[model samples]
Target chain A: MTDTVLATQAVREESPPRRGGGRNPLRHALLIALGVVMIYPLLWMLSSSVKPTEIIFRDPSLWPSSFDLGNYVEGWTALGAPFHQYLLNSAIIAVGCIVGNLLSCSLAAYAFARLEFRGRKLMFAAMLVTIMLPIHVLIVPQYVLFSQLDWINTFLPLIVPKFLATDAFFIFLMVQFIRTLPIELDEAARIDGCGHFRIYWRIIMPLCTPALATTAVFTFIWSWNDFFSQLIFLTDQDLYTVPVALRSFVDGQGATSWGPLFAMSIVGLAPIFGFFLAGQRYLTQGIATTGIK
Target chain B: MTEPDRSAPPGGALSLASPPTAPAPAAEAPPAARRRRGRRSQRAVRDGRVAYLFLAPWIVGMVVVTIWPIAASLYLSFTDYSLLRAPRWVGLDNFAEMLGDERLVSALGVTFTYVVVSVPLQLALALALAMLLDRGVRGLPFYRSVYYLPSLLAGSVSIAILWRQMFGTDGLFNDFLALFGVQGIGWVSHPDFALGTLVVLNVWTFGAPMVIFLAGLRQIPVMYYEAATVDGAGRWARFRHITIPLLTPIIFFNLVLQTIGAFQTFTQAFVVSGGTGGPSDATLFYTLYLYERGFGSFDMGYASALAWLLLVIVAALTGLNFLLAKRWVFYGD
Candidate 1:
């Protein structure tokens, strides 16, 4: 079955030369130019973050005339809430989301993949339909619900539902991954007098490390970058995430300090870049697998 | 969670009929042990109750958290519920008010226009890039990752901040325009160009669809192209006859997904317009309007109504696309 699937994929790989018939050198140059255009803004931001405030707008090029690392220190201290506290809040929320998503999603995925139950197909379909539901529809009601429970301004709004499998997309992804594993291992564990929970904890979880890693990376990035929910739920400046705190750099009176804002922006995005680099291998594999399916 | 018995009444008959295939070890085992095993299997089937036990939290969560909130929002849309007071039964008053509300009408208009214009342009750009990367080019993976980097950072607040700098007065975009002997209009500051800047931002994140398109492009059979080439078809002709037809389904998929996404856009406009949807509310997208009503003004009832309207609009558009796709989206059956 696997070979057949691979063969079909191979057959599908053989198209798309008609539009790529231009001169190779010109095409390569154009592609590189496009990449540079796309990447230059980021490079500019990184360079400007280190430049002194007076020279930021003065230099229009990709590189700064001189590097002044004081911008980082100044920006960090000048933020309304200490940058470190916001960073800590972001880290806690992100890590909590990751842990909650993995445990709840993997358990649900395993059950959906391996167990037989009534209404399984209907329940699965309902889960998929939720993906189509626009999130804006849920915000007000969710806010009201959280407020009634007195969970406002607390991490409960962000981290609690994840532990209960609130997001079904990750669970579906885990289900698809778990379904590809062989069933014989489960049967063998059963014959040895093990139960379903034991099989899940001892055998299934260990084997699905790659999927779990992918889930963790994605959940971390998403929760870290989440601004809308953070903006709504956290009113206190001390409770802000990095993204929320960064917005305060732009004065509502139309005066934005480009140097300090960009500096803080770079600092904010550093962890995401670090995380992506650290998990590059697993991320690519996960993208290739989940995307194709 | 239940296991099927392999040596009960039906199993015994099957075992007797297929005795040759039945394991000799099972036959040598005492009848009492075999019966015990059968009973154990039956018990496993009957008492496989832990499956639901494992799923209990998620089930309760779906009910209390997701389902209840959705139902509450649906009911709230028909009432007048400002955050300050108890909800009053207004009975379609919010919807009626929305119809006559000029700001809401224009927000929907602006949102529809953004979705209609951006989705196709983005997909076309993505497909073109995907085709360029599919030529077995060296450093293919690196280029793919570079292109995909924008998507990873696309929706973040930092990118929105970066967008303001790029399109603001005296920004890089205007500086580039200067070299071409053309003056830059206020891209993000002027009401006329504010929405255009947003469209550009939406177009910039074509990387995700481009990756999907690359995967889809790889799936096409090379023999079909060879056959077309042998028939003396030129590059353009081959593309017209073969590539375009095969790529329709993916295009349709991207179109639907991107449309749904674009209609719900909030952050870029919120950040660019300074969270006020200003420059005469030209950049007031649907969700941003919803945010203004629900959060900024605390008009929960009206916002709920608008939210339901957006859900309907998205679902209707997606449904319409699928219905039309029957005619255009070719399957490889």
Candidate 2:
């Protein structure tokens, strides 16, 4: 499975073809082609967004002969509310979710990781089991509960559960991260008369920037892309988030604006893709480190 | 309330690494230290209070959001509770009704087929791609990130909508098929192929399990392969002997997770089929059907019953996987 000899032979045979290159060029070319195919839809969407609406499906080529910038301009104002309003709405939810998850999940993780508490092991197991609890199981009653609170068509329903640490995945992620940190720090903090909360705030929190950032980035992206919960909770158009607003472009009663839909889709992906690029290192490292262990 | 004997060593998610060998024996304990040690019982009590204080949000959420909803749904499954009216007790009538409901049965059939087909294919693709990357390739990180991009977009509405467009009659895929002199039907619309397109879509996002497999691949010591090669093992021989057994744990994890995830697929089918699970219910995923019953037709009782049924199925399948795992999943002691 290691292919050690093949690697060594490739290094020897391919080195003269190109200095510092040991991998087979054919394999590189093949993988590059496959990568392009993997990302083709994204490229197709980008190209289609600039093509004339009438000719979008008519012309299947990725490169358009003529550029029509109307899609971005029209899609922005196409829906009843301008695109920025939806962006702002999504931003609010994303930020709220990140803050909620970071504070509550880290607090819970600290308790699970460091503090010796009653029923700690059982509580931890309960949380882990709930990780597999299907969201479908909760939707009806949650919807009913929110409706009874008169929170239908409101951001509160979409955002409040996040604040209460409803996502156990992040809690588990943080617990894994905290476990990797040495326990002696907490012991030393205690020797200096720092209470559990103080050690958590002053010591563990400072050392947990990477894990917290992972939690924040993931929460932001997940909330930003969340469609079902937002679709169900926010019925009014004016309060629509990005995903909800984007859905409206397709779900319009009349002709669908394929051009604008693609255009807005690209626009919607910008921030998330940007965040992913910025946080890619931590994201990959975090998953690679914790997922195996 | 007591210290709970930390000397016994903690367990669960936190203690993947064994608890630190009971603190090195104290060589220079004084009376002042002994007095402080006597206060350790008080400290455990204090930690308990502090732990609950920190855990208040999760505790409250588990009750109100999770436990209550699960309990209520279990009850509502047995009672007719439309939003406008109080629930009327019906006992096992909903489950009995399920026996006769063709759509519910078809939905289960659809869901089962999806799980059975998608999980293995996805895992195989993931393992294949992971092996490709594991070959010590150049620029592997870039390749990994690009490949992983799709998994990140897996459940996004935009991607589903894009998939719908790409599989439409005049879409990119059909156009590409025309180049091959093959006539292609509307993939997302044709009853025969709508589920197939969803299956392909599910398989296409194999990056997640691929990554997990890569991580697992890294865990296998290279020395084993060196030893195998020294014994005259070839590529296939080494893979069969050294890789498969060691990687089974990760494979099992991916299998269980992906199976559960495939069973709950909603947004893609919902978006592709325009939230109706249409084209004669060919694309009617289980969750989509549940949504249709619960919110669409307001058959809350039936939907609640379906929800419980799904939970039971998932639990049983997961339990089954665990039981079977003992036979196949190799843990290096």
Candidate 3:
């Protein structure tokens, strides 16, 4: 970042932009310093996950003298059940959400983006409004409703809403994506005697892969990391998702085992970390596109 | 619903609709043209039905999940609804209770401080770093990914746990302070500093805004900057005059989002303070208090009221920002 933007920006405005690629070591120093500060905690945690327990905090140097999987082994079974059970629970919810968002949201989005329908404008506006409605307002009533339906302590409450296309944000994202596809494609399909469902399944779905991937990845990550809802819905020890189980790690008496705690925390974050690495293009690009008008 | 509307006044509608246009479909046009017209109308009618079919899931979700719950939440706010028993209406009591609630006031204070202080700092860092990364730089991808990692992990319990220990008495922050011969207090436990640490934690995850700002900067046509440069505009002048005005919408977008998100922040405060929002209630965020009231104590009615208040505050602030944005947020058009 030496040739980066900062070049005594406040004082040297008159300096030619870039200074002919001159190395502004000072700018590199600043960014590097901040970057190190930004990542130090994570590095420390990663390092401690492998290091012995006695010197975990005694040495926060982000380097391990010993390569030990002992903490990981201990953390896995430290809870009554193995920690992977929580990971599995989180994965089940994530998979359900991903499938739900992809199927239901894309269908609704195709209608909004390509079809002519009565009440389309009104429905679109309603969907947008739900985007801003705080989840808190819906929480109490939803809890009550779910409890009445006998869905408490079950994944149904967490997973059912997605099947109904309740995650309006994804619908909006897919709508934006589908709208960008040429209308001629749909017209061409219609000329071939294809109906709306056929066109949605064949023409539009194939073209909206990026947007669909974005929705799927986001749903996976959000469901994987979801807290308040899961905390409320899941009470049984066998049903705990990664986030809830990790919180239990803190609330329980074994929280003092810092090494195991950090190890399990890292385990919990693994899938999300992997998804971020693999689908970062979708993640960042999706926000860039969806966030703007 | 759409299908019924198309046929509700069947004979009168078709007769009334057609006479003014064609007089008689059978007699007015050539056979091919008439067939095409008939097919097109059929297609139009089918579109309405197909639209509803496509929208079926969303309509159900909206009705059963969102709309009903919103209504129920409003109703619950005015009642004494405990899970163990039936709801008993007590109009205005929940709202009145909030007015006199000390912890609610303090919670509001804590929430506002977090929002006001953290959101701006986060956006400022985001924008500044965005500006830096906007210019052609080596290893841009590396830096972007490194920074964006936190935002991905920001809401996760893992990060929250990391944050707690990072600010604990023997945590890394204090250890850093130790290098300077400075005796560091337990930042997460100190009443005055608990919220501040959370503020810093919030700022640490400014990556999403940074990425969005970077994208918005890229969208500005290069011609604008070049034109400014030719006009003897210094870097400062170009940035201040050209960039700020153009990027206002993105800035406003990030501001509005960060503020709304900050108002609802739960995980960090919850995990940091061990779900107590403690250190003498110094870190008791509004949602944390709501969680305590609703789930911890089963004050469902009062909790609903608090939730509604949150909704109102978020809506008001967002609306106010939109109004304010007209003066500052410039559309490229």
Candidate 4:
């Protein structure tokens, strides 16, 4: 049945290409053309990062004239601290958010999906409203609250919220996923003397690997790429995440370091690009099934 | 809060089609229907206890992390509070000031223009590509991954940075135009074209909505298309008659979600315009303006008021879409 999911992710299913109009070659030609337009900017950046600074714009060819490795080396230390410091900061936050979303969102999802507790429907509706609420409305007061707590310039303001399943989107995703599992498994577990916690922890969670992976992957990407909150919170240079550090380069040392900036831009995008190559299935199916970006 | 452009929102919109608002996702429903064995007081009590135990962190988080901030923001919007000062009661002053604020009005105009222009273009591209690819292309996954790559990273600082360079005076765009002996202005720095570049950037990442459209298209039984063709319907006729009506829900869904996402754009404008929304504020997105007010100047009260304005605008627009959706969004029984 889950193979139906594989089908929807668009490539894994072995469904035959629709047979019609005898226009297969034309379709293939158009796709290749569009694909090149889609990927050109990225390829340009990748090549420009390795090109000599003076020739970056002059040589518009995607293949660089000279494969200079200086940009990567220079950009590494160009931001005052080494680039790895920023990456490490981002990694710490992403790991914290992933573990937080997995643990908190799953528990909430289970309650919403299977348990018939009092106020479950009401709580679920309230959670949905949270999803619809724009973060702009909350950021000011949240900044105020964090400042009052003296949590600004620390990852506490960023990492701590996820521990509470504040990301209702993941909870909503997991609830939809958990509802698909056969209830007979829970019924049988109940008959065998398993309680709700046991059924949730042992039975349901093991079956939710796909949903968990979805939450984890998205948490990492969003946290790693997140700018607004991070920009506001991490003003101290030492606490800068990748996004903040990248912006600083644009602000302070932009003109002389075009090549280095592109290098760092490539560096910032690599983990996610590599992540896409690795977890393409999870990323696409996550969107395809959830009808989300 | 998760970034606006990625996956945080729109996913919420999908839940509108799911439980609490509609029937359960039709798996194991019969057993759930038959289970009158539930609702016994002892079982109910035990279930509630266990469920709350599992839900402890989420419940606490919801109140402290989400609800508290929302309530505080609403309250803050009504006061003259700056950081390090007591929040002075100034009911309606902040709202009153917004009317006379030129930057606020410019921000509103810029945001509305962005939402109005970029969304339809993006969704139209998405629907067009989805239709083209849904016709069974070879390497569908490869095409999808290549296309979807930008949507995933478009919200990042790197992409925004690249966008700035791509339109800079000596950037690749001008270089491309140079080949035709046509003079290319610095698009990123040009007030006339700064927001246009951003609009083009939004339209470029049509892959996300396209993927959703593909999934929705798959849900349409091939037999319908087959029958239509057998009855002598042409390709355009089949799409107009069959595909259009059936695809309306997905179209409306993308419209609302994308509109909301576009309105919240900050990183692109912040980066492309060098945190000034400059070239004379042509690309000053509303969120960018809000960030400038709240963080740049530390005007928490006015910023909070601006935040509420954004929330209401989004909510009203979403409400309006649902109302308009009834006129056109179709559901097949």
Prediction RMSDs, each to the true structure = 7.1, 6.4, 6.6, 6.5
Worst 10-residue lDDT window, candidate 3 chain B: B1-10
Best by lDDT: 4
Looking at candidate 4 chain B, the ten consecutive residues that score lowest on lDDT are B1-10
Model 4 Cα lDDT, one tens digit per residue, A176-290: 7898799999999999999888999999999999889878888889999999999999989999999999999988886667899999999999998887787777777777665
What TM-score goes with each of the models? 0.88, 0.90, 0.90, 0.92
Tens-digit lDDT string for candidate 1 (A184-285)? 999999899998899999999999897899888878888987888888999888898898887766643243577778888888888888877787655544
Candidate with more favorable, higher lDDT: 2 or 3 = 3
Clashes of each: 4, 0, 0, 0
Q: Could you give the fnat of all candidates in order?
A: 0.36, 0.43, 0.55, 0.61
Model 4, range B227-284, lDDT digits (tens) per residue? Answer: 9989999989999999999888878877877887888898889988989988888988
How do all the candidates rank in terms of lDDT, highest first? 4, 3, 2, 1
The 10-residue segment of model 1 chain A with minimum total lDDT is A1-10
Residue B232 lDDT, candidate 4, scale 0-100: 100
lDDT of 1 at A67: 72
**Colliding pairs, model 4:** none
> Which rank order by TM-score, best down to worst?
4, 3, 2, 1
Clashing pairs in 3: none
Report the TM-score of the second chain of model 1 against its true counterpart: 0.84
